[model samples]
Target: MLKKSPVSRLENLWDDSEAVGMSEPEKLLYRSNLLGSDKRVTNYGGGNTSAKVVERDPLTGDEVEVLWVKGSGGDIGTIRMDGFATLYMDKLEALKGLYRGPEHEDEMVGYLPHCTFNLNTRAASIDTPLHAFVPRRHVDHVHPDAIIAIAASANSKELTQEIFGDEIGWLPWKRPGYELGLWLEKFCRKNPEAKGVVLESHGLFTWADEAKVCYETTLRIINRAIAWFEEKTADTAAFGGEKHPSLPPEERRRIAAALMPAIRGMISEDQHKVGHFDDQNAVLEFVGSHQMEALAALGTSCPDHFLRTKIRPLVVDFDPASPDIADTLDRLRGMVESYRVDYAAYYDRCRHDDSPAMRDPNAVVYLVPGVGMITFAKDKPTARISGEFYVNAINVMRGASAVSEYRGLPEQEAFDIEYWLLEEAKLQRMPAPKSLAGRVAIVTGGAGGIGSATAERYLREGACVVLADIDAEALSATRENLAGRFGPDVVRAVEVNVTSEEAVAAAYADMAVEFGGVDIVVSNAGIASSAPVEDTTLELWNRNMSILSTGYFLVAREAFRMLKAQGIGGSMVFVASKNGLAASPGASAYCTAKASEIHLARCLALEGAPEGIRVNVVNPDAVLRGSRIWQGDWLDQRASTYGTDKEGLEEMYRQRSLLKRSVLPEDIAEACYFFAADTSAKSTGNIINVDAGNVQAFTR
Candidate 1:
């Protein structure tokens, strides 16, 4: 059980019952998971752990020691057994002989693959040598916030000595590689009694022969720092006290919704970007503080934090006392331009001859005073994770600045890590982005078959999808199903009745805050009505118009507003029907409303042409499978129109099609995908008849 404390403290969570009967590698994984479960201990994918386990060699048929460490790009909190890279310990030791020195230590990475034990294909990380060369059998290298606060202080070495004395040692800042590994090996040999070491401007590394001892020692050390900081900071105000009061939660969110799209539009010149807003207490406190700007400008201290957040954040100038969002937005372009110029200058000044060419000059993290922090990246999870890393940095700043002068990594050192050749190689190795990468899409009526299918298609192509529908239960189920497949960060849902103007507008606001902005709009929300012209009551006609025509119009109007605000151009795929192009008996109301939808698309296409917003139509007919409309009176009406019962209606429709095939929701989704994708870039105002070759619905 974790002990309750007045000030939050890292809990020692080792359980003897949980450890019983576990193998050595299993115990290492367990320890890693326990440590990583708390963000205070390590941010996502920010740490690595290892155990040297003796195993039977497949080739030699004899026992040999192997290093099982968290592989490159694996998160210890969620890693599986296979997520570890297994290498022969003797081969790793032999690498000491091949070491050319600190300057050439990068070559050591190339030799690691040669030492893969049991032919494990998991790639070893740069930190691999650090763990492999440690004299202790089990090692935990983590970035607990309290420990990092001490490590990132200007007087880090002194503080380390003052706090723990000889119980823990301290090391000068050195980039993690073969040289650092050798240094660690030397430190352990010189001070075998020390349980751990604080790496200046980096993080903590603790070790012991037993996995349980190593785990306990790591927690004990971090908890000590946490306790020490709590006592020392009891009377001190954090971050030089607050200079700006925080905006109310709802008000801050409203501001973020207005600003994110504008900022996203400017920074997305290279690629489409997704945004994440964090107004958590830590973020609000840091952004509202007097020292926030100075501390943020100094950049992050840890290599992991620096890489994700860039050398520093671009702090937006805004005041809650005299709020003027309009003025701030007007000045945003100039501010962004300045940040880009400064980043480029930094790149130019720090480039080694062998350094990769400059990457995106745009800042990843943006600090908004009195509001909170916003981060944008190639995708949603990255944006969210980047924000989490900055939060860790904030905790470090609060502690270090309160007790000792906070220190950021020197710019030159930051550049070295950011542009390291190995880092560039990792970037090059990434899979090519999918066609819809970074695109955010809203699918109205998203719980229905066609709408859900369209959202799935977009998700498969790497787009973040927002599902909008009035059916709360169905909407939640659809959102959960997609989120499970595509990750929660890339999928969200909002309860919206597109016919309601207020509801439609609010959904757009939610989208802006959740995903930065919108890129594609699938105006698919609709209802079907069938009545002969002589028998069509005013109520029936108006209901059809309300959902089929007015609803599409409402959603498209909101899409136009957001697309224009972002000024990045977007696609609007309106799911009309074949009846729009071909008159159908006994369905006068539905036909007229759909015809109006088609014409509306044409008008919007012409208006949006100059802005590069593309508008198109997909006319699907007789889509019977998994359709909610078909489950209602529309099914009986359609069957009666064809002179058939419900069971034979599908076959009759299939036989009536020129190709003798039935249409499916997935089929309509394909056309929507085309319209939403770049494949339809030059073909605005066009309509595709997906009725299996209907002569009456021919576009020509």
Candidate 2:
């Protein structure tokens, strides 16, 4: 059993007058720090925090005590008082004796009266009992990224013992809430003097009488772990020649502030903000030369941290002067997809519940080769702290692995932590509103099959849609077909040449006025021009570019201005072509224009990111149904080029794709809806191929 020391810092801190009668302002500050520290320690909302206070009883003559644990769905970092769920301490303590096993959880819940469960408030923290079990005045629990790095190692216990020398107690990972609290209760009973405890594959729990001491102790323990690991695995020249980038501090600061509000909104608390980077030459050099595949498999430092830092770092292949931002972003998107697949596999192996899982990568870490690691945060302060913690975790994990292979938690265990009831409740508490509901969307070239299908899909998804085409008769026919299915208010018709700026602008303005404000703009209005490069006239080239490229720009710009003013994040989809991926004979103008639209969407994505705007391109290869450009002479030309009849040429186009089936315009529309909806929150600057896997363009 761990023995208690005569001078326990926690005891002293709690007994101090400053801690006992802290000012409201000071308490708020302490609360903010405690929440921020916990958020940093885990991925997303992986941990919980609480403050105990005495309240006057209305009927009784004495004061009633309650523990205000962070409510479910509320992130500790930005959580406010309302974000907490107040529970009677006495009632919580009684719950312990009623449940003997995991199976009894439901029974125990049923025993509580409706009054005992506060539906008006956010769901109670899952760890409410855990915090209540601890007799400390204040408690802080986190899956500290540093500790997990060590725990995930094969000889984690040995390494931890060597590093901390028995100062920290290690607890095996257990399902949180009642079960873990029971285990912790037993551990604390035996080791009364232990200053803090580390849960394997979970996080750290530290407490003291004073908020500051509690907060600092958590940091100290992490630092001690880092220092010990650094001493053992210090690489002298591994990171040499790496220097920080020459970005202005002001620019970094502004970006940090702009991001803070959103992050703060998620966590519900504010703390001092600062930014730091592993911009030193040595660190950059080391990261650049490191084996990325091996390093990424190390897993996240802590699960809660996932909400802020994501599962894996974005690896940048050492190019500081790349003019093509789109290409670089493509590479990143590929890496993100790989990470998502890995995450899905991990979830499938571990998940036991029916709850919907989040697909968004909560946080992103930059592993810039030849540049040191940089962790982005909602604010500068959190970013700097996160960077330090991340660096330490990396060093420790690498050192531990050097001695023996590192092993992460079992899939089920990670799932349990990630989908713990407390955290799940948080997700349920504040149901995020659909920001784009009841808005209008307009697709250009709606007379075409793809355009009409896309417009119909948008109407089905609750958006009032206007289908525009250059042919008035065709536009009217499409409106008649869709209006009966989607209802009269859901579909409208317009006829205009998308190539003419004046005509396109006038249409957009009228649509905005008619529909209130456009939320989605699908720039699908385009014409195909095919001729040998030498024979392609300048007039043909200009005509294609004018409609396909410049037209897209004009429509998207108008939508952006409208969305910004409406204070809503809007989505835009540009219909480019598979030819945008590569050059092809007799389609030089068409290919160039399509490529230009792709680039334009990429730029829009970046500019709109801050304002919650999303822009993506759909590259459809050979969508032939109802295409005006695929008729008559155009069809004959394409047929001749393929050495086949019109029917055979169409079959060849469809069969060339990996799936060997003709992709319907509706399929492309489905892909568009994904980008247009809340499902793709983190997806921006992405180009999805609706070509049935024909063109496997390399995304960064």
Candidate 3:
């Protein structure tokens, strides 16, 4: 059932005299009003409004000037001619053919030149092609709330026909720009008499031979639908309930600012705004009830609305009987995840083709319990409009559900729409590069195979290195050996135990202040202690854990805080042994500690992703040559136990790998560089194996 609002008097502000003998300023004002009257009617810059006029060109004869189609970032309510990019009719129409023969729509949009004056601003509105295709002198496209409400409803097509049966034609949602333009071209060709087009989950397109006709038609359609919907779901008690108390405007603004960073990459700030559904009696009654989870599964009214309102709302339990809000939040998050999985399955079933789905949910409507609904948006206008639409949709869906289960787009079909080419194109934009460059990296246990080789590779790639070891003599000697070849600043010597957090922190802090900031931190410092699971003493376990696990956390935490505060995205690499992935004979403590570090890195990767910080771990197999762990009696004891000579033991280890080659520290360094450089901008929360393909014993 649809709810319709009472029809008000038709307000036509512009008269024939005012329209026919319009001065430039008067015409601009009229155009602004026609475009800006309805917030839900359009997105920030999603739609374009234009008027045609004859103007003189200096070099060309009898030019048809299109008043600046709204340039990017210019709001319609206050937009002026300066906001519009004036283009010659022929020049604008020629763009239709610019992207020919198997070109991606996004690539076409990207190549479109930024408007002449606002070079630094966003490119022109994406609806330029559709507007240009219309022969009408005045054109407008809007994502009107009323139109979208019907479009999102299950009976949308039927509802639309009932409301505007003779005047309107419906167009299925398609990626904006090229695909949409092509669709409209075919549609208009089929129905030349059609005055307007309704794009499902998108908006409405209305054009008229005259500006007043276009404006009047838009209002009439919306008003008619509103009237019909209100009559269908006219329950006087639908909104009866206690209203949630309001928060201070400043407090609301602060909360919005806090949430902005989390969603910035997905939605622009200008497109986001905070709105309160406090006064909505329906919302209050719904939130006060206990069906929060079911209420949240309903999809957003439109896809673009996700940028304004998140795909679902956050249902905060504010009851005094609730034990913990944090726990409640955890449960809600679990619910969100559950809904996401179900939604994905639904999309997969409905999809006719294969395409990856977006991992992030687009809209979230919160059930604030006693606090009412709080909606998030990329910008304020979007937020307000999205909130209103969501509330309205909720009312309608509930009404329909009272009679029967409310159905949504099939799982696969929804997935198809969500993973559509246009949406994926938005993800293809290149992000900024990592900030750490021209800095040095030092890993302790330098003479040890992994440590020494990592240091060597860093030096070759232009990083000054410091190889620190407990053995002062070995440390000094390695420094002397590498200094002549890689330069003195490229390598330094120090003696320190990684077990001491104070020592590790001081060392990294000094290096940061000395080198402008520790751009990269390789916590590749650890001792391999072998003791059978039963024989592993608590004391031995604690020592190994303190040195390997705790030490890495201390070092990484300091580096991350400094790098993040410095506003630079840093890279941290951890070298956990293969023992971290699978159990090794007589190495319980070592395996546990290494496993802990691996988990730590995974957590850091998630937390650091938004900060442009990337964290990854490289698990390398045993590299016996030059490793302190292999030197002295350690290798001989292991070899004797395995009933093989040291050489044979080393060969066996190399043969165990899928590549049939020994894993080297340099191999690990290559994996480190992938996460550290711009080449892997989209790579995070990944663990790469430098173990020459040890498939059986792999890390998750």
Candidate 4:
């Protein structure tokens, strides 16, 4: 059971007496962080908190009560004082006099900005009135999963009485708005002794004279509710089966790989890009359960979840034993189209005159009987977040079913929350997304310096990146580092030997399963070898040819197939060297291999043009600083050939270029991004030389 008192980390922020020197907002900051830090309490930006304080107005020099509530787009985990929007209490509460019901949803949004005590303060969260209407000096609200489980049950009122013994008030489902706030205020007047109110199919609220008391009350109520759940669900046989069943992992992977591409092709609207794919073990177990239909049909366990996961997930009928990929894809396409049609009809039936226009009707989650759950969204992060929320919803639904029949709000109520004007206003306030926000990119040789730099650049442009390399240690390290910045959902590491066709094919198949399909392929995996023609052995030449020439062919062959399956125009970039064009002495093996790779790109470009796939090359020279090719004997030979130290030799190469600047991996990355991104949509079968203005290496 959760502790009845707040987990006070305030001591970490201050010594015994140091807290006395803190300001009211500063105290709330520490308290807010504690509340937001728990995922069970909040997910991403799901909850809000506030404290009542008296401060003098700058103009009037008179005391005023200001409500410091968490602002929109603020995550409590790392929120600062600026995250709290200060509202004049009198000004905000007076709006209750203008109770216009749910129809004034748009008008309520318009009036919020004008209520801010300072014009520069961030917009308060939509639940601001819920905090303002309460009589307590401090309020804390969170969508605890355990609390939601009970509140969404068919016997919610009974459960509330059992858990709180009439100490808490229960309100029926109402679309959140001015009227909901008005109703809460009346409940407080009628039940003055109640510690909190459980909002049906919404969340929980607790209040007290002190911040700590309110917070502790919230946790205590949640903990008691969780205790009731555990006692009721103690019989494992009643819940049935494994929480996660062992359905051959290989078969699950195969099914996801085959189904995602078809789903992407159907949902994608962008000409050159498609959505990302993600799956979870919890979701897989839920779909495999005998009670899958019953639990899912209950709709969203919480109204806020409708914004992420749709009102109900479209369960795609898939058989793991199906033998034909093409046949299976055709069947899934028909099902998905029907899902869209049904969604349109639902919207038409439920919408009011003030309702927002319906959004694209693509199903977010695909529950395959044998294949687990597949989530699709414009980008990997959103897909991953959606998958996570679904997993939690499944848990809540199951928990509720164990206690009583799970009951979510009606479909019309869910529709109201999904298309609420307040959410639209918040979305419109965001900046434009990056160019390749929904695209998936794969970089071969990705643990290497140039490849890693290229992967980083694609992620910066908002593309989901898969780093494929033969070096396991480097691949793992690079993946962990990049995941720290862009999140694990958008960054993945795969071990691939480009020389082996099996390895290359498996890499693309996994990419299809992990991210639907590929929109960009960077072929940079190769080994460098240098020898005079007379001394060049067949073994050395063949080694270079296998890695550089054959590897490029294998990557392109698989990439083109997946892109064609997706029916989306895509980009393939081969990383060649300037030495292919400008012959260097004792570099026959390297130059010959590069030449073959470069020409292969042009040939593939010619064949792919009819399908709108563009193939290009980036030729870079003397990127020696971080390159593995310039180590040991190779470095010695290059320095000996130039008649100078390694440092001086670098300067000589820099001067050889017309621009007189040393080329770096980032310079090559920029050229690759241009070819892969929509910026160079009209260019194809072209070579971009990143040798700092190499005159001889320039494309003809």
Candidate 5:
């Protein structure tokens, strides 16, 4: 069950009952979770909390003061005890003597590991020194939207003086590091009674000797800001008031669906990127605001916001007043290229000598004046997080601009942090992406044995998959199973019958909106019909053709449309049967439809070759294990035709093959994966027979 906020004033969710008998570090964890719970308090991974505790030193057997702070890249909201880096406060204090001023501060990070308490494996974040240097035993540093609104104001210092009057102090912006830590230490020493300090254009930092007091102090300070903004903006216009009306919700999604794939294609030329589309109220309000272009041009205020979202978003050329999606598509390529060129210029102008080479220049956030926002990134979660961060920035802008002029970080300063040697190292340390990291796949008959297996294979390799199946219940189950393992962000389910043109088209369009565009298409939907040619009714023949042949064509046609639109080469794997090549007795309808599937794939391969779309086939024979088709009358007929009971049918097919091995769904899945992956980059219009060496199914 979702926890309800206890108070209306900015979510005071702390319950005394929940904090009983907790250790200092445990209290710190609890406090951190509370502050990080609401986005209004802090976005994901945006804040840090610390507590100093007395602990017996592993080496000296004497009590020592230790600072436990959230570790690098860890989210406070979901952080565990192991996620904190435990360091000796004495060691951190002793390092002040070694500090060679601001210029040499980057070297301080190298000594952090030396201070590791009890040899904890968690790496200390850059903010560690800031926590250690503070005189208070507990400190809460968070980027609350309400407080950031005050911090990001042009007259921020004056506003700070008016709001909390010295109870909470204000400091000019400084890049967070060893130097800032010392600066904060000096500030605390001078203002002994000050409860907290707001870092200009950054966030709030509150501290108290008691952990509970510290948590409440942070909440109270944020609530004050919220109250101030509410009272002040009650009569004022936000973001210079709305300049453009928001498109209707469905219309907004339709536009987003149309634009995301095109944007994804342009940006994903070098490395594929997954996408996320958000049209939440905050997003729509900001995008439709009069000052959106002006403020967005100034860029985000918070460093975390600026990092997740780029310095600025790409304002898509869309006007809800007179919407034309086609015109927007035509102009999108130039706009994207322009953004790249401008980003390159920014990098070239601000880069230090040791800066890493310019990274992907594509804009992470795209704002449509009418239809909310789109974000594309190396993966789905990152894209979604980028959008979330932008929304936070919008909230900051909304409140800040209503009362005072909002300010962004200076360009050179932003560049310094973006290319900071420490940050660059962190980026470099990230593990290599999986092979299908940013690819999106659509699997027809995705709830079936072979289809589900193939979808899992693609998902394991890091591709976002849309499971399209006619059976809603099975699709939901399959999706839940896959989503449980790969995460909900990477798996989606659509109830679709491949035989319906409209359903197939709608599914592809939905897939486009969900994960940007398609990279892989697996056509595995089928029906197995059994009858001698003389006894085959037209209904039986048409049923087989409708599902096996026509369904494959419909799916491929939609896949081709999207593939060409994305301009990113894709892979299509058709799961045919050995009967496509070698006729089977008493199953002429199924065999003929299977042949049509194979031939349809060949034709598509020929047509799609120039577009770099590789069409391939994976054929299997007597794959009775977990096959939905094999559970019906077709199985009985096949068994009767072979003069064997159902129990012995598989043994007959295994012995009949050149290799006496029974085929399973996983065997076919492996073949589909090969064709869908880069391993088969140079091959197309090819068929792999997974029928345990069926000589008759072999290619001529």
Candidate 6:
């Protein structure tokens, strides 16, 4: 049996302040958050909510009924007052006479803006009419996986009665629009006893006069469906095809590693349109199932999933227990080609003159037996979202399969949703993406001042960054900080002791496995040795030289090798020092090592030009902030040597520069960005000084 009421967890969170101060719209928003908080109820930005209330018009001060519906860009989980687009009820209801059916989709869409209650300019969801016509104070619509499983199944009406006992209403699949709303309103009026309505292969809608009642009603119905599913699937186990010997963990990782790079390469349209890959256990289990090919061909459980995952997933045949890598690779290539061909044919068959040119035909989901289902997208987050939805859809399919047989909306229905202008409008509302949208970058010493700053810049430009550093503590802190700004998965951290050749190679290899291949490499790992040539010990000189010179060599070598293998020319920026070009007193070891690094970049530039690779250097000086070299003993000694306080020394350096400005880590980071980005496409073997106009270090 279903839980008669919601768990009441959110009610505990609704403290006295919120409960006392809450208005009708806020109450509706609170319920939206409750529904969105549960993934089973709504995936990322997939549902809508609304409430009808009487409010005074801002200009007229006359009380009027209004429908405050969730706006286009508003996520239910994080909606606020501004996220609701309030429409005058009388104005919206008048549109009912204007809408006939699917033929009026464009007209209805065009007329919605004219009905705005306030001067609000936000675009409301297409389902606004569906909420407006319900005639209930509060209405909640969600794409719960459990409900979708039942609704998409062949025996949906039979199961609906068995589960809800006619307490819920059923609306056969109608494309959501003015027509859906009209149908739903008439059905609710005729069957006043119905607590909720299930839209076949669409989603569920539950409503009542009170906010809590509407929310609880939704929970009860969804839980009822879930209870039935659990009862029905209690004895069923995952299908894993014919049993083969399982590979060891290391072997599995190796297979995944090899498969990801090839998958990324195969799906990439070009260097500029490179995509990312991701997978999970559930995805692997589904892909490895004996009936995967048959079930997946039935199409997605719902139309909403078609936006992220195509109508049906592409299947690739492979046996992990087999030792023939060559054969597996050949099979993968052929399957990919076949998928692309089939996708083009599907597009040709369904495309109308008004339809947009076909999107890239690459299969978002690649089902590899014994390995897993790999999802591809232009970025990591999108790829991850695709993989998640695919897993959820598979679960729904399995549930349906267990009960009877899995069935879903036809391919044309999916195409209708996929190509609908209303659906595409949501995507068009987003700002243009950054230039490095699908690229990956790596920054050595990424926990330090310049490295961390550069990583942040790259992320802002829409590139995934790998922060490689030897300091575990600092690395964790930097990763956490950056992850908070962009996303948890955007900035990946790898522990790398630059002086260790093995560590350097492993770091690059790991990045290749994580994000396919590297596009930009910022070689910026080094230490300072400030001693008079006579006083400099062999240990001190060797220590500085090892990190400054040898570390650069190891990192650059591996990056070059990987870039060459991938056959994609890339960029590399070395963080050399101004002292390398302009000798400084008592800095022989540091200057010599930096000078060596600069010359190495020049040599690599010459070697890589033919292959379209570019190597450059940024020379920065007197950047003390966020510099570990300026802390502890170094700070005290430098201050003593300058015969002043730390601030005094900083001022001295600031005044010494021709520009009379203190050099900063961010200044160096900008130069690195120039080299790593397309801005320096025509230039290489060049050194850009970031020392606030250092005349002595000038190079032309």
Identify the candidate with maximal lDDT: 1
Q: Per-candidate TM vs. native?
A: 0.98, 0.49, 0.48, 0.92, 0.97, 0.92
Cα lDDT, all candidates: 0.93, 0.63, 0.61, 0.80, 0.91, 0.80
Could you tell me the TM-score of candidate 2?
A: 0.49
CA shift of 444, model 3, Å: 49
Q: Which stretches of candidate 6 lie over 4 Å from their true place?
A: 1-21, 240-252, 270-279, 323-333, 509-516, 633-647
Model 3's number of clashes is 42
Instruction: Return whichever of 1 and 2 wins on TM-score.
Output: 1
List, residue by residue over 639-662, the lDDT tens digit for candidate 3. 765679988987888887788898
Using lDDT as the yardstick, the better of models 2 and 3 is 2
Model 5 over residues 280-312: C-alpha lDDT tens digits? 888888899899999999998899998998899
lDDT, candidate 1, 1-700, per-residue tens:
1122344877778899999999999999999888888887888899899999999999889999999999999998888899999999999999989988888999999999999999999999999999998888999999988989999999999999989999899999999888999999999999999988999989999999999999999888998998999899999988988899998888998999999999999988779999999998889899999899999889999999988989899999888899999999999999999999999999999999999999999999999999999999999999999998999999999999999999999999999999999999999999999999999999998999999999999999999999999999999999999999888899999999888999999999999999999999999988887777999999999988999999999998988888888899999988999999999999999999999999999999999989889999999999999878888799998888878999999899888899999999999999999999988888899998888878999878
lDDT of 6 by residue, 1-700 (tens): 1112345222222334564668888888888887777767777667799999999999999999999999975778777778899899999988877766677666697898999987998787788989999979999999888888888878887877888887997888988788888888998999898888888887899999988778888888887888888787777875534343345555655565566656665666463433344445556667667777888888786776777888888876777667566677667778889988998888888877777667778888776666666677778777776776777688778777777667877777777778887767766767887877877899999999989998988898888999999999999999999999998767799999999988987787677656767778999887886777898899989988899999999999988876765556789999999988998877789899999999999999999999788999999898899876777766676677667888798898888899999877888888888887877899999988898887889895
Which has the higher TM-score value, candidate number 2 or candidate number 3?
A: 2
Query: How many residue pairs clash per model?
Result: 0, 33, 42, 0, 0, 0
Once superposed on the true structure, which residue ranges of model 3 sit more than 4 Å away at CA? 1-29, 40-46, 65-67, 95-103, 114-122, 235-279, 285-295, 317-364, 376-700
Error of 6 at 506 (Å): 3.8
Query: lDDT for model 1, on a 0 to 1 scale?
Result: 0.93
lDDT for 523 in candidate 3 is: 78
